[model samples]
Target: MALAKLGEGANTGCMTQTDDSLRDHFLVASPYLEDAGFHGAVVYLCEHSAEGAMGIVVNQPLEITVGEVLDQLDIRRERPDQPVYAGGPVQTERGFVLHRTGGDWHGTIPVSDRISLTVSRDVLEAIGRGDGPRQYLMALGYSGWGEGQLEEELASNSWLVTPADDDLLFRTPDESRYAGVLRAMGIDLNQLTNTVGHA
Candidate 1:
């Protein structure tokens, strides 16, 4: 399985909430975040901890299609029209599936009761056969941060954090996801400034 190469480092672990953890949240890239890959991105954070953080860029679709991936793995595509996502900047070759159903698949990690992340081929096989979770997004690679790295970025006002919503994750159009999230938070993009002042 190509996903097995991700190894134990990719495990999502149990869904444990901490005062500092951003798990099950959305990280919206601030306009000040000049990184081209993350600019205007809406990231679904799957894990966050004192150790680090991991997430998928939910709104960036690659040119590749789900059908192409199924063909590569020899899995018959029951639904072939979905686009694959560029999950993050790290491990561009690895694949991760953010799904909305619980199943005992290999390398499956629970993000929440309604969401999970799976890195094994069995889930893909099931999707090909129309037997997988009801809704899913397949992404290649994921965004990650080392200990204190994300905190430093947060302190720098590089991102805007919001509670994750299923509608935003699965229904919003890719082109507008970043703006949509901001709107949902009652924020006007034009009103935001690059400079954040401390009280």
Candidate 2:
């Protein structure tokens, strides 16, 4: 996985139009996907193009708190302790903010009409002051794929992609996100198998 600074805005050069892009979608790891980093991961695709795709693993929470991060950044902690999520395997030290679109912030990229991705410090500052977007997820790092890489994985059935919903992204519990996505797709987890078959 290649990691880039989210604060630099998205790298759109490599992106090309496909029949349909997965932006503003949810990628649920298939049962056959054995990569420890992605197993059972439910990623929210913020950007996708021929250049590649970038997303955050919404279900994996690191053993850190929002208050701790604010303290480290010297931002006054005014909110209660919130769990910080592990976005993905790339750039573990970097941060990405996934939130509802409305608040103005530096380096904010609208993923869709309803959601946005921001990496600037100003949003974090606002969050610390309780004036940030009403709904936000603070993630450290993100998942990235090279051009055509994500499509290849999709062809191999490594992921089950679905349109994202606000409930799944912001309201669902992290631990149940993977299954919740599957349920939203009308798939039962108990009946799923590792075998991939073609007609």
In order, the Cα lDDT scores of the candidates are 0.82, 0.82
- TM-score of predicted model 2? 0.89
Off by over 4 Å in 1: 1-17, 193-199
Residue-level lDDT tens digits of model 1 in 141-176 = 899888889999998788999999988888777888
Give the C-alpha miss distance for residue 76 in model 2, angstroms.
0.6
Worst 10 residues of 2 by lDDT: 6-15
Our tally of clashes for model 2 stands at: 4
TM-score of each: 0.88, 0.89
